[model samples]
Structures are given as structure tokens and as C-alpha cells.
Target: MSLQHFSHQHPLVFIASHGHEIEKVNCSACGELVSGSSFGCVECGFYLHKQCVEAPAEMNHPFHRNHNLNLFTRNPYLAGTIICDFSRKTCENFVYHYSCNLDFHIKCALFSHSIAEKKNVEFQDISRIDPSINTGNVTEELKKAECFACRKPLLDSIYFSPNCGFYLHAKCVDLPAEINHLFHQEHPLFLQFNSQRLSCKICQKPQGPEFVYCCSPCKFALHIQCATIPTKINQPFHRKHPLILQSVDECLPCQICQETTNLNDFVYFCSICKFVLHIRCVSSPLIIEDKLHHEHSFTLFPRQVLYCDACGTLGNYVPYICSTCGIFVHKNCISVPRVIKFYRHQHRIPHTYFLDQNESEPWECRFCLEEVNTEHGSYFCSKCNYIVHVKCATKNSRWYYEVDSTETEEATDSDEPVDLREIHPHNLILSGDIRDFKQCHGCLLPIDTSYCYCSQCDFFLHKACAALRAKKHIWFHYCQKLLKLTSGCIFQCCMCKYFTSGFAYTCDKCKERFCLRCSLLSDMPKCEGHEHRLRRFTGESKELCRGCGTSVHAFICKPCNFNLDWNCITLPLKTQHSFDVHLLNSLITLMITIIQEVIIVIFVKRKGIPNIGFIIV
Candidate 1:
């Protein structure tokens, strides 16, 4: 469409407005009324959005590949709905377009429609339009137009759908809150910010506001990211199993949906169903019971008992309670109605119902170097007592397969699906606390999650974050503890190998902020050969340190031109460095060799190297 047809579309006429009345469908940028003729504003003037001119009667986007895109005639920014994107198996929401079933952000659609057609591009439906509106009389109730989001009046920036008598404040037409993005099922994603993540409930694609739904309650939840799946399912992936809408009351921790499920936020998922969960919700069973392996019934437990003759994981999976002697054994141990086909050994081990611990020689674990007591266990053959840990026996978690029964969408009152995605690796706890520093005590990520801080020495991390991946990481020699960073102490960054002057992970003893990863230099591959393992700083305290005077999130060690972003503390240890010359992580032994040469040379020379000083051998 081009501006050539606008001469016949609308004629300038006087409009009455006691305050502000609906005027001609116009391009606020240009005096010409927008009636679907022309490119942007009259060639020399800014034009009204194309979507504004030809308001859709109905629309279905390609991205929203599966849903029925219904065109709504009313404002959608009125309320919200709990959304679940069946694709990612997680959701994030708290806002919606309005009461209308418009799925796309109003602003997003406005812009998309406006730019969809290039300037002067001839459209097949081109024709001179009769664009005229009668602002004959203003009703006392209808005259008061207001924005539903910010609750402001229709000011300068506004969008009106003339075909349906709908209106919205331009600014309020699009708005989304920050979320972890727990509303998808297939693809992995996080917050897109204002980049426009609004999509459809059925098609798993981007859409406009006309194809959405909104709730009447708080108006905080949104339906754009929802799956619109009906409460029942029978798909190719799960024909025999039944899938239903998650009930809010049944908030059991999902084994497959949560990465930890340690907190109480678990909701609607099926143990029997083969549906997978979000990365944040992936978890395996710690305890279970079955009647197949053991002659008697047995329950699985997560604690260690006497060594088992078969799998030796210190009674960690789950143990079965005996009706007699009060003895507990792993279901995979003792009794055998048992004929099992071994994958690794490739030999069928016939059922041997021997539960006697008094056997002459107890079996030893083949994988782990550990002794096994024959009491509550299984033994292979006399010659080869190849032992597998009970935990390792069922590594696939279970012996079952099903079709991926994706649900046919229905209007559901479900909350955002559980966040089965990856954890915020940076949200770990800071263990070694000190003053004026704000960094993770353990991983050295950042101090965002609820954390512990030291008034004397600022350190922090939420209790749960501190415990994350703690088993794999122990403290380094330089820093006594990997305390969370807090306010009150000065810090020097461990990364960028610079002395941070502001808030960071600092040592109380040395009064310096050296990050946990940098302090663990010896534990790393290339850092082993350095003259000294990067321990907590041993520098003496001095007042007026530049790094100590800044805010909590930044780690500034000015003397060395070093600054650490407090968020770096939780970074993985095997991460590759910037100055290492290689794009990949250095092998442990090779890394150690490089460190040795660099630090040794620096130690002997008594001065920094020409260009390699920061390359801390």
C-alpha cells in the first residue's frame, strides 16, 4: 500500500472533544489519516502502524504453529492467566495483555504489522478506502478512556482498533516482568527481557494479542506461554499412560522435573507417566521399594549400612525392611526370584536366594575399591565376583519406555509449569566470609540468593546455594573459607587476576578480596605450576584502599588494575581463561606446567614479566 490512495480514503472534518475524543484513524506523526493507504507517514511524515490501520478480524501466526488464533475485539491487558509452554516444560508469568484473548504483545503486533509490508509495496488487497468516523456525541461513560496496565489515561501514545472499538495506551500495550522462564517444555530458555518473548499457547510460536486468554483475579498471570492443553492426553509417546492437568493441591516433588526438588515448590507431575520435566526439576529417587529382586519385600534408603556383597553404595538408594530380624536390605541385593541379564558381563546370572552373611569370603566391589559383606547382598560367580553399586545398577532410573504423548491444548487454570531447566549456577552460596566484599563464599559466583553475611567481614549466600555442588569443591589454601561476599570489606578479584577495590570475596585475615576460583589455582589444571598456589591473599591491611570504597556487586582492586564482577565466584572451575591463548580449557597437567614456568620465572626475577606478568604460570 502507498500514499497514492489516501486522497480518496479520508476527508478532513472538524472533531469535537470536551476533553479528548476519538478522532480519525491517523498517523500521529503525519496529518494524513491512516486508512491502510501508503507507507509510513505520507512519505515525509511518520505513519500510523499498519496493524492499527487494518485491524485483524482473525490471525494465526506461523510460530504459534498449532493453536487456533482467535481475534479478540476487546482490550486484553485486563487480567492474566497461568501459562505453560508444553515445549520447555516450564513457565514464567505474572502479567497478561488484558481481558481479551490476544496472545501477542499489543506493541509487538503493532510494530510487526507496521513493518511487515515495506514502503510502496503493492498489496493484493489494495483499494481506495472510505475512512470516516462519526464523533457526533460523547457518552459520559465512554468518553473516559484509560490504560489498563499503568492505569493512566490515553495520552499521546495510544493504539485503537477501529474495527472492534478497542483501545490501549501505547506504553501499556506491552509489558512483561522478569522471570526465570519456567513456561516451556522442549527448548531451553531464560528471560528474554524486553526483546519480546510473547507467544501463543497452542502453536509454540510468537503471536498477537487477539489469540490469547486472560484471568480475572490478580491480573498478574499470563496465558501467552501456556500450552492450552486439555486435562487429558493420549499421544504417540504415551498411549497407555494418562496425562492430566496438574492439580494445585497435589504439590508432590517431581523426581524428573526438578534438578534438586529440595525446596517445597514442586507441583503437578506424574511418576508413572513418561513425561520429562524441566532441567530445574530433574531429580532421581533416593528411596524406593519393590518385590521383584528380593525374596521378601524391601525398601530403599539413602543412608549407608554395612557393606553389601553385591552393589556397594553404602545403602544409599533405598533399603527394604525385613518382617523378621528387623534387618534392612537393598531390593537389588539378597533374594532372587532372580534371573537377570547383565549388560556389561553379558551373562545371565540365575537367581541364587542366598541371604547368609556368614559365607566364607565376602565379595569386593569391582568398580570402587571397597569390601562387601555378604549379609545383605548378591554375588556373581565364584571366580569373578564383579560387584556393581546398587545406585549404579539402575542408572537409566527405570526399565520402562513410552511414546511422547503430548497433550491437546485446552483452557487450563494451571500455574506456570515447574522450572525443569538448569539451575542458576551463579546462585551458589559463599562460605568463607569477610568484610566489605560481596561474592559467593564457595563458587565465587555472586551474592544474589538469600545468603549469610558477616558484619565484620561481608560474606553471604542463601543456605541452599552454599550447599550446591559443595561435595565436589573443597576450600583452597589461600582462602580459609569460601564465604559469601557482603558489605564492610575491601576485595581484589580472583579473575582478570586483578586486585578488586570494591565489594568482592575477601579474606578476613589478609583483608583482601581474592575470588574462590583464583584461590583454587592449584586445584586447576594449568595453575598447578605457579610458584605458589593461589591461596587467600596474605597482604597486610591498610586503610584507604580504593577497592574497599565501592558498592557490593563490584570487586575492584585498583593497585593491580584488577576488578572482579562478584558474579564470577560461582563460575565452574574448569572454565577456560581469557589470556590463556587457547579458546578451550587447559588440561590439568599442561596447565600446571605453564603455571610453574611463569611463576617460577617471576619469583626468580623479582619483578613482573614484560607482557606475561598476568599469565600467572
Candidate 2:
């Protein structure tokens, strides 16, 4: 006779006895092998035990006395899987659920009810028959005996078969044989021993020889803990679209941390926008409060941007914004240093958003030698009129160090108005006015204004140059030795290779010489001919100097393709020559005229010139 059931669509036929053809059939209600009398829907491949087919829709089980357990064909929760309280495994078939977070499999609920009534049954001595069991002071032997179901130690309530050496947790003995998960919907996952040591696709963690939900054909597996992760989630930061859990083979950058995700890691992705976020970044904080960077708090702006106001570099993804300051900056730029001491400059520089504009002269960066945009942020020294790009100042750790805001800068002798007798044999007087032209003995540059002069000898030094220390450490020198200030002999500079009679910083150990101008130059030198900083040419072959057209040691401006030799770099700004009636405008022009004169003399010598003796002085 055919019987209608609420769980299945088709009418179930009563099978009075199990035959060879239906021996392997499992009950659809409890997912257990059906043995005795049962109901079968041959067309749908569905079956159920006689007791399960006659079970009531609602009942007050003794295990949960507070509420009535209602029968459910599928999980009632909107997301994630439901685990049975008795089996400790996912409930994929019919279950008895209560609104108060209690659930049980159909067979488990029936067997539990039968035991409560003291029915005649085999295996009545099972430990699970008694709800309470003493688990205190468990011996080492019992601790070593792990449950065959979950692979966890059977320290508490468990079902033990001494003759068969089979151990199972009280709650694990009735685990469902198979389950269907949201992560993999192609096939039903079966509860099996993880003998191959496969990693869970959801958490990407290696699984030991334990029970897991696995699909043999697809080689997909998931731990019981990882199988509960929801397939879709609504993150607070990304509210436009709900992110779906997905597996990716390529490394993609996470929008929150701006770091590349590991290959083959599970990520929360938005298929509609192609937005990817690392699984870890899903819980990033919405707001950050850093007192050191700014007075106001910064809120995370969860969108891609092109620029950052702090570092002035291209921003990749999300940026932090301070609404009070009306600025958008990178997350990494929030802690940028406010004041720093650069190795190239004597005074400390402070960060500023915009420089004070002098209409006559635009601000130029001392490091890159490029025009500074007054609208953007930069490092500036108001005392020395020195300014540099923010990136150039803090590019390298060895170039600068942060300075405390409250610390006072040390005063130099140049700032003081006094006569010095210790520096020279005669008292040197500081004067702003001098009638005759004088050259500084230290740097050999023209001392036009604010200089120290000695009456006993022709000793003169620029006010700033006279404040130099007796010994100093320069970063450009590889010897890492302190160079001493020495004078009185002409020597070639190791850096610029220029021969000069000016003061030199000499290293006694390596015998390396550096002229005053070369020693004072930073690693990146400023040049007037080009709009960019010049770097030393350390190539194997000599570069052709653009100034004199000679292949020699030179400094190059790569962007401009400009090169300057030492001889051209150190040429005085103004010079007096007998061949010119007025003072030569520039030493560069004088050198060019000399080159032209030599070329004319060679042409005259090759042809013939009568009594006009072409002489070059």
C-alpha cells in the first residue's frame, strides 16, 4: 500500500522486507542504513525506516524540557549549516529543532526517547544512556583513547566497546553520514577519515587524519569548524555590495591593507564590481584615532583614489581622510615625521603644506634642484632659505633622522656677533662692509658681504664658512673617518678632482683629499645649468662633458643629458682678463672664448697670418 509523507513529495510504498536489490539503501530521514521494515519511493531513490516514517511532527523531548522540538526537513537558519546537539555534526537530513538553539537528528531523537522510557533494547549499558557521567581525574589510558568519530580524546561522556576497541564521544556516535554545504554545491559531501591529509578549501589549513566533510570525485574537503563559514556576508566597510566567498589562483591586492594576498587563498569577492578583499581584512576597523599625527581622528574611506595629500604619491586603493582638516592621505602617511635633521643641511627642517611665495623668486628644492610647487607639501628651512621635496628628504634612512619638537637647536658661531682670536693669530673682525674685493680663505668663494677679516694678513672668510668645525664626518666619503680642516698647500680634490688652494678636509689614514666646495656638497649636487640635481658619474667609461666637450670625470643630470667636468664646475663666476675691456661676465663664457681663440690660432697657423701675432693670454 502507498502512504503519503510530509517530508517526501511522492507517495512512499511500504517495503515489508529487505531484499538483495534494496540492501544498500539508506533512510532519507536519518541518513542511516535501513534494515528491517521501511517505506521506499523507488522513482525518487528515497527511503525511510518504519519508525522514522511514523515519527510525530512535534514532541517535547526529555533532553530539552523547556520547548517543543519541531521536525524540519531542511535547516531553518538563513546562513551557515546547522549541527545536531546529539551528533555534533552537520544536520543535512530531517532534524528536530527548537527555537532555543537545540537541534537533533531524527534517529537520535527517537533513540533518546526510547531510552528515557526504559524500553527493552540491546546495548543498554552504553555510557550515553546516562546523561551525567563523572569525567574528573580521567586516567592516561582513557585520555589516549580517542573517539573514532571526531578523533578527539574521550575524556568525558563516551560510548566504549572494550572487545572491539571502538571509542566514540557520546555526542559523536550518531554523526550524519553525508552532508550538503554551500561552499561546494556540485555534490553531497560525505563524512570520512582524512587519510590523504588534504587542506580545507575554506580556511586553507592542513587537516590531519580526522573526520571531515569531503567529496572524493572533486578532491574538495572542509573541516567541521571551517564548514560553518557563511557563503555570503555583508561587511560594514563595503556596504554597496555583499561579498561572496570565492577561491582565487592569482594574487590580488587587498583594498583594506593594500597588501597582495597569498596565491590560492580564499577571499571575499564582489563579482559585480570585481572587488577583492582578503579574508582577514573583512574585520578592519572603520575609524582610526592617532594622536601623534593629527589632532583630529581619521576615518577610513573605502574607495580607490589617485593621490595622497601627505606623501604626494599615487595612492593605490583605500585612503584615510581627516574631515576636520579636509585632507585625504594614505594610511601609511599618517605617521610621517614633522621635523627632521638632514645630513646635508646644518639646520633642522620642518614639514609645511605650502611655502611662502616670493613673487620675485620661486622656491627651488635644494636636493632635486627642481622648482617646488607651493601648493603641495615639502620640507623647508626658513632660516637658511633651503627647501626640498618631501620624498627626497625622507627617501633614505641614512640621509635624515627625526628631531624632537621640544628640543632646542644648538647655536652656531655664525649667528653670534663677536671677534675671534682663537681661529687665527690675529683677531679677526666681523664686518658687513669692505671697499676692496676679497676671497674667502676657507671656500675660496667671493666674500662680498658679511665676512671676517684680519689686518695682519690677507686672511678672509665668509661669516658662515668661518664657523666650520675643525673635524667633521662626511657621508660621501667611503673611508668612514673624520676629515680634518687643513690649508696652505694646493691639492686635487678626490670628489670633484679640481686643483685648488682653498681649505681642504684631509683624511690622514686613507690620504684622501677633498676641496672645501666638494666636501660641502651633498650626495646630490645642485646645478644652475640644469633644473634637476646632478649625480656623480660612477660608470666604467668616462662620460663626455657637455660644458667643454671632453670625455672626463663628470657629474650628470640624467633627465637633461647634461654633464659638467670638475674644471667647469669650479670656474669662478666673474673674472678679469686682459683680452676684455670690462670684467668677464662669467668664467664659463671666458672658458668658451679661450677655446674659440685656440681654434682660431690653429686655423691661422695652418693657413698663414702676416705680422698680426695672435697671442692668447
Lowest-sum lDDT 10-residue window in model 2: 411-420
Provide the overall lDDT of each model, using Cα atoms, as 2-decimal numbers: 0.35, 0.70
Query: How many residue pairs clash (N, CA or C atoms closer than 3 angstroms) in each of the candidate models, in the order given?
Result: 133, 0
TM-scores, all candidates, are 0.22, 0.41
Which candidate's lDDT is highest?
A: 2
Q: Under the 3 Å rule for N, CA and C atoms, how many clashes does model 2 have?
A: 0
On residues 27-47, what C-alpha lDDT tens digit does candidate 2 reach at each position? 989888889999999999899
| lDDT for 563 (candidate 2) | 85
Give stretches of model 1 more than 4 Å off. Answer: 1-212, 217-222, 233-243, 247-253, 261-268, 271-617
lDDT, model 1, position 387: 49
User: What tens digits encode model 1's per-residue C-alpha lDDT throughout 156-260?
Assistant: 344343223233443333332222223433342211211133543223345322323322121222332342334354433234555443432333323222122
